[model samples]
Target chain A: MATMTQSGKPADAIGLAPAAPIELDGITHNYGSRLALDKLSFRVREAEIFGLLGPNGSGKTTLFRILSTLMIPTGGAARIQGFDAGREPNRVRQRIGIVFQSRSVDVKLTAAENLKHQGHLYGLRGAHLQQRIAEVLERVGLLDRADDRVESLSGGQQRRVELAKGLIHAPSVLLLDEPSTGLDPGARRDLWQYLRTLRDQQGVTVLVTTHLMEEAEHCDRVAILSKGKLVALGSPAELKAKIGGDVVTFEAAGPEQAAQLAAEIRNRFGAAGTVLGSTVRVERDRGHRFLTEVVEAFPRRVESVSVARPSLEDVFIDCTGHRFWTEDAQPDPAGGKNKRGEY
Target chain B: MATVAAAAPQAKTASSPGIWTPAYSLWLREIVRFYRQKARVAGVIATPLLFWIVLGSGFAYSFHSSSGSGSYLAYFFPGSVVMIVLFTAIFSMMSLISDRNEGFLLSVLAAPVNRSAIVLGKVLGGATLAAIQGVIFLAFAPLVGDHPGAGAVLLSILAIVLISFELTALGFAIAWPMDSPQAFHAIVNLLLLPLWMLSGALFPADRASGWLAWLMRLNPLSYGVDALRNALFPAEHTLFPLDVNLGITAAFCVLVFAASWAIVNRRTHKPAA
Candidate 1:
C-alpha cells in the first residue's frame, strides 16, 4: 500500500526498493486562468485496480490526459514506471496503454485489423504481431468476433475490442478514462471481471477514472477528488471506516422545514447536523438511540427518519462538505468545458 | 480459464517509433477505408467527369482559345484532370478532421510514434489516392483527339503525382488547425477554388488581362497546370517549358509538407484535440 504524509507527499520511498507503477508528485495543471488540478499527489502500486473518483470539473479528466501523455501539466510531473510523462512522453507512452473515454477504434476495420494497426504502432511486426493480436483478442473473449467489422459489433463488444487494442502492445500500465460510460448492467459486470482477471493474471496495473460510486467500490483502492483537490484516498472499506459512526437522516417537506429542524436539533442536543435541500443529516455513534430521541423530541416535525451504516458517499461528504452530485455540477452539453468551467 | 501464471512484461529500453512502421500502417488504413466506401470512389471520379463534360461542351461554342487548340474540350482535358486531382486531394484530407473528432487521432497521438511520420503517412495516403484518380481521368485522353507518345504519357503521370502531392500537402496544412468540417469547407471554397480557377485550367494565361494573368503567374498551381498542358498536348503552345514547371511544383510540395510537419510538432498550452 502507498501512504501520504500530512504535507501531501507520497511516503512510498520509505525503505521501498522499486518505485510505484504510477506516481503523481504534486501534479498541478491549469487551463488558462482556471486551476484544474491543485498540487494533487498519490502513488499506485503494481497490479492493483486503482480508481480516480470525482465529479465533473474535479480535474480527473485533466489528470487523465496528463497520465496518458496527451497533455502536459502547467506545474509538477506525472511519472509512469519512473519516466516523467511531460519530459519523455514517448517513453511514458511506450510503457502505458490508454483507453480513451471516446471511441478510438476505426469502425470500418474488423477487430483483428484494429489490433494489428495498434500493434504496428508499438513496433510489433509480421507473424509475431499476428500471434499477439490473436492472443489479446482471446484474452478479451472476442476471438470469435475478430473478423467482424467494429461497426457490426454491439457497444459492449466494441468496448471489448478497444480493450484488446490496448492490450495488443503488452503495456505494463493500462489507463482507462471512464471505461464504463455506456455499458449495460451485465456488460459492466463482465468488464470489471475482465479487469480483475487482467490484474490477477497478467500483473498489469490498471488505473481507471469514474464518477459512479458503485464503480469505485469495485476498485482495490480509490482516490476521491472534489474541486481539484484530493479529499480522501484508501480502500472503500478503509475510507468508509474513517467516518467512525452511523449516519442518521431526517427528511422534511422542504428546505425551509429541514433548516428549522436542523437548527432545533443542534440547539437541543448540542449536535451538528447538515441541511442539504430537504434533508438534515447527523453522524453519531449509536445512531438508532439518537434517532429515537430526536423523533420523540419533535414528533411530526421530522416527517421521516432513518439510520444506516456509513457508506463511501458519507466519506465523500465528510471530506468535501457537500454531496457528490450538486445541482451546479451538471456536465455541459457543449463539450470541452467541464463542471468547474475549465476547458 | 483459471490460470493466473502469465509472465510479467519485461522492461526494455524505450525506443521511439521509427518512421516506416507507423507510416506504413496508417497509409494502409487509409487505403482500406477508401476502398470500403464504394460511393466515395464513384463520387470522387464521377463528379469531375460530369463537370468536364457539362462545362467543356457548355463553353465550347461561346469561346475560342488564343492558343489555337482546335476545340475547347481539348483545352479543358488537362484542366479537368487537374480538377480531379484537386478535388480528391483536398477532400481526402478532410478525413483528418473526422479522425480527430471521432477520437482515432487521439490514439495515434498517444502512441510512441513520430509526429513527422503521422504527416507523412496521411499526406502520402491522400496523394496516392489523388494521383490514381488523376490517372484514371488521363485514360480518357483519346476521347479528346489528343494522342501523345509514350514519353509524353509518362511525363503527364509524373506531373500528376507532383501536383497531387503538393495539393494534398497544402490541404493537410490548412486542415490541421481546424476542428469542424464546416469551417474547413468554407476555407477550401474561399481560398483553393479560386486558385484552381485561375491556374490556366479553364482559360489560357496568355488570353487573360493584366491582373488575372499576374495572379496565374503568382500561383504555384499554375506551374503544375502548365506542366500537364505541355505533357498532354505536345503540339499546343505552353506557358513555360516542362522542366521549369515541374521544378516549381516540386518545391511547393516540399514547402507545404514542411509547414504541416511544423504544425503537428508545435507544442501548445491548449490540448491537442
Candidate 2:
C-alpha cells in the first residue's frame, strides 16, 4: 500500500509510520458565546474506517464542518493530508470528499449531470472528466441509473448519486456527516458495505460522523464525544473490553429510587453503580450470580434486572457517567427537531 | 466495474481553480434547471405579457405621455420590455435561497472554486434568461405601431442586455444574505417595485412633478429604460440621450456585480452559516 504524505517524503523516511489522512490539532470552535468544539484533538489513521460518535451536542457536526473546510475553526487547526483546512482550504477541499447530512445532490439534474458539474468545480473536464464520472458511478452501483433524474430515483439511489458526486475527483479522504440518516435498514447496510469496499479496495480513508450506536459498531475505531469533549477513543470491542466484565442494569421506580439502589449496591457488594435517570448499572465479572444476589436482597424494590455483555452504549455510560440519550436528545412530542450544539 | 485509482493523486497542494470554468459550469447548471422547468419559462414570459396588455389597455384612456402623438400602448412598450427583463433577471435569483435550503449551495461552497466565480455564474445565468425574454418582447414592437430600422434593433438588443445584466446583479446582491424567498419577495415589493415604478416606467420623467421627478432622475434603471425607449422609438423624446443612459446603466451594472462579489467573499472571512 502506498502512503500519502503532505511533505512528499516517504513516511518511513521521516521516521514516522503511515501518515494520518486526517488530523485535528487542538481544534476549537464556538458559535458566538457557545463553544461547539473545545480544544479537541484526534488523528484518523490511513485507510481506516473512523467513526465520530456523539450525541447531538457533542460537536461532531462542527468537527465535520471544519474537516470539510466549510467553516474555519475559532482556534487551532484541522489538517487533511497535512494541508491546513482553514488557511489552505481549497487544497484541503481537493484532497477530501464530503457528503453532507442533508441531501446535497441537485434533484433537478440527472445523476451524471450532477457528477459532471461537481467534477468541473474540481477542474476536471473533457473526456477525462466523463471517464471519471462513469467510473465513480459504477463504483457506487449507479452506472445504469446515471441518466436518471435524481428526483426520480429512490432515496437510497439519490444518496448513491451524492456518494458518486463526492468521489468524482478521486479524493484521498472521504468525510461523511450522518450518511445513513434517511436510509432504510437495507440501504444503510449497503452504504456500510460500499464504504468498506472503498477502504479495502481503493485505500480511501473514510471518516463518518454518526449518532447511531449500531453505526459506530461497524467502524474499525470510534471516537466517542460528550459535551464537546473526547471521552473515549478506541475500537468498539476495545472500549467495551475496558469495562472488563458483564454489564448489569437495574431499573427502579424513579431517579431517587435508582440513586438509593445504586448506593445500596455500592455499600453491600463494594460494586459502584452508575445512576442514569431511573436505572442503575454496575459492571461485574460474574453478573449472573451478582444479579441473583442483588434481586434476592431487594426483591420488590428492583423493577427489572438484566445482565449482558458490554455494548458500546455501556462504554459510553462508563466514560460519560450518563445515558447515551439525554432528555434533550429525545424526540419532541410536539414534533420539533432536536436542537444540536446546545450542550 | 472499473476500479478506482489504486493510489491517491499525491499531487502537491495546488491553487484554487480559476473563475471561468467553474463559473461556466455553474452557469450551465442554472440554464439547464431553468429550461427544464417548463412552467418557469412560461410564467416568466406570460405574467409580464399579461401585465403589459391589461395595464397598457386600461391606462390608454386615463393616462397620456409627454410625447403626445403616440398611443399609451405604444408608449408602454419599452416599459413592458423592462418589466420582462426585471422579472426574469431578478426573480430568477430566488433560486439562491432554494439552493441553500436544499443543500445544493453547501456543495458548491465546499468545492474548490473561487467565491467570485459563484456570483458571476449565477448573475450571468439570470442575465442570459432575462436578456432572452426581453429580446423576445422587443420583437413585438410592430404590434404597438412602431417600426425600427436595423440600427435601432441592434441598439435595443444592446440596451436590453445591459439592463438584464444590471438588474440580475442587483438581484444577486439582495438575495445573497437572504435565506428565504419570502424575504426576497418582500424586498422586491418594497424596493424593486418602487424602483421601477419611480423610474418613469409607468409615466415619462417629464410629466412627473417635483420630488417624483427627482426620484426618477436619481434612479439608475430610469437610464436603462430611457436608453431602451430611445432605441425602440427613435421619434419619441427620451429623458436622456442614448449614450448617457447606456453609460450610467453600464456603470450601475459593474457596481452591483462588484457589490455582490464583495458580499459573497465577505462571508468567507467570517464563519459560514
Candidate 3:
C-alpha cells in the first residue's frame, strides 16, 4: 500500500508532487465469507474531480462508506486529510463531507431546513450557518427551491438538495456515492458543472463513484474497479490508451458465429480478436484498415460493423471482459434495465 | 476565478475543531423538531394528563380511607407526574430508532462531532422535553385535587427531571442496539409496562401482596413514585421501612444514567456492522 499527502498527490510520485486529500492502504474488508474490498488502494487528489468507476457489487459503496467513517475496514487503514479513518474517525469526518447513494435529505423538511439541520450537526448556526446554507444552495443552483419540500422536488432537484446538504459545512474533502445516479442528462450536466466549479473555485477535493462511463470521463483521474480490485487507475485518456489502439467491433449471428468470425479475422490480420457474446472486437493501430480486411474476409458473417476511438466503456469491457451496461446472468442488455441505474 | 478566490480561503478554515458546536447544535435541532411536530407535542402532554384525570377519579373512593391525609387525586398527583416522566422518556427514545432509520443518525455519526456529545445531547434533549410534559401535568394537579406546598412542588419537579433523565438513558441503552423501530417499541412496552405495574404507582406498597411488596421494593420506578408521593403528601409515612427511598432512587438514577451513557457512546462510536 502506498501513502499520499493531504493534497492526495502520491508521496512516491517522482515529478508530479503529492496532492491527494484521501488515501487508502491495503484495505481488505469481508462480510463473513464474502470479500467486499480486496487489497484495495487508491488516492483522491486535492481540488481534483476523482471518480471511483466500477460496476455494481464491485465494492464502490463499501469503500465510500469506509472513507466516510460509516464503517471500519476489516483490515488495513484509510486516511482523510492526514487523519486515520479508523483510529481518528472524528478528525476524518470533520474534514470530509459525504453524500450516500441513497437520497439522505429529510423529505418532511424543506430543502433549506434540511441544510440548516445538517449544518447544525457540524456546529454551524445562527447567521453564519444561514449564510453557508444560502451559499451552498446557490452553488448547486437550487437557491430558489430552498423553501420547497424535498419530496416535492423532481428526482434531479432532490439530488441537488442532497448535494447542497453535503456541502453545507464546506468540507475539505467531499465523498459522493453516485451523486447523479437517477438524474436526467441535463440535470447530470448541471451537477457536473457544479462539481467542477466546486473543485476549481473552492479547492475542495471531490471524490465520486459512478458506473456511468461518460460521467467517469469528467473526472481528473479515475480508478476502474472490478470484483473489489482496482484493475486500472489513471486519467481517462491513459485508461483508454491501455487498449493500445482504436477498437473495431462487429456483430455476428451468435456466439459460435462471432468466435468463427474472430478466428477468421485473426488469421487474416494476424492480430488477436476477442469475442464478446455475438460481437467481435479487434484492436489495431489503424482501425479502418483492420475493419476493411475483416469485412472483406467475412462479409456474410459480419452482420454490422463499427470503428471508433476507445472509450471508458470499451476500456471496462477490455479489462473486465464484460460490457459496462450488461449485468451478470443476462447477455441481453434489455433484461437488465434497472441494473444500469445501480452505476 | 473571483468566486474561487473568495471561497478557497474559507474552505481551509471550515474544518477547524469547535468542541461545543455539534452538541449545542444538535440539541437545538431536537428542540426545534419537537416544537414543529404539534401532534407529538400534544400526545406527550396528554398521556399523563389522561392518567391523572381518569385513574385519579376512579381510585378516588378507595384512597379516601387507605391514603389517610388527602383525597385520591392528591395522593395520586405526584405518582401521575412520575408516570408522565416515565412515559415521555421511553417514547422519546424511539426517536433514536427513527433517526437511525432515516439516515440522520448516520449523518451525525459521520460528522466531526464527539460521540459522547451526541449521546449526552440526545439524553438531555429528551429529558428536557419530558420535563416540560411533567411540568404541565404538575400544573393540573391543583385543578384535579390537592395542591402541594411550593417547596414540595419544586422538589416534585426536580424528582421528575431526575426520573426523566434516568429513564431516557435506559431507553437509549435499550434502543441503541435495536435494528428496527418496531423492535425497539416492543422492547419498551415489554420493559415499561411490567415495571410501571410493580412500582406501586396504582396502589400503595403496604396494600400490595407480599410478593408484590418485594417486587415494589426492588423496582426503581417505585423509588421515583415513593419520592414524589412523599414530597406531595407530607403526612403519609414512608412507603418502605427505611427512610432513604429518595437516596436509593437517586442512586438508581445515577446508575441507570451511567450505564445508559456508556452503552450509547460505545454503540455509536463502534463501526457499523
Candidate of highest lDDT: 1
Docking category for candidate 1? acceptable
Task: TM-score for candidate 3, please give it.
Answer: 0.86
lDDT of 3 by residue, B64-110 (tens): 63645657776677677777788778877887777765666777777
lDDT per residue for candidate 3 within A182-294, as digits (tens), equals: 88888888888988888888888899999788889999999988777888899999988888879999999999999998888777778877788999987777898878877
DockQ (Cα-based) for each candidate? 0.40, 0.39, 0.29
User: In candidate 1, what are the lDDT values of residues A200-292, reduced to their tens digit?
Assistant: 998899999998999999999999998789999999999988877899999998999999999999999988888888999999889999999
Worst 10 residues of 2 chain A by lDDT: A334-343
Chain A: TM-score in each model: 0.90, 0.90, 0.87
Off by over 4 Å in 3: A1-19, A107-117, A123-127, A142-157, A325-343, B1-19, B55-65, B69-76, B240-243, B267-273
lDDT of 1 at B99: 86
The sequence of per-residue lDDT tens digits that candidate 1 reaches over residues B178-227 is 88888899999999999899999999888899999999999999999999
Reference-based TM-score of each model? 0.93, 0.92, 0.86
Error of 1 at A101 (Å): 1.5
Interface RMSD of 2: 6.3
The candidate scoring highest on DockQ is: 1
Among these predictions, the greatest TM-score belongs to 1
CA lDDT, every prediction? 0.87, 0.85, 0.76
Clashing pairs in 3: A7-A19, A7-A20, A7-A21, A8-A19, A8-A20, A8-A21, A9-A19, A9-A20
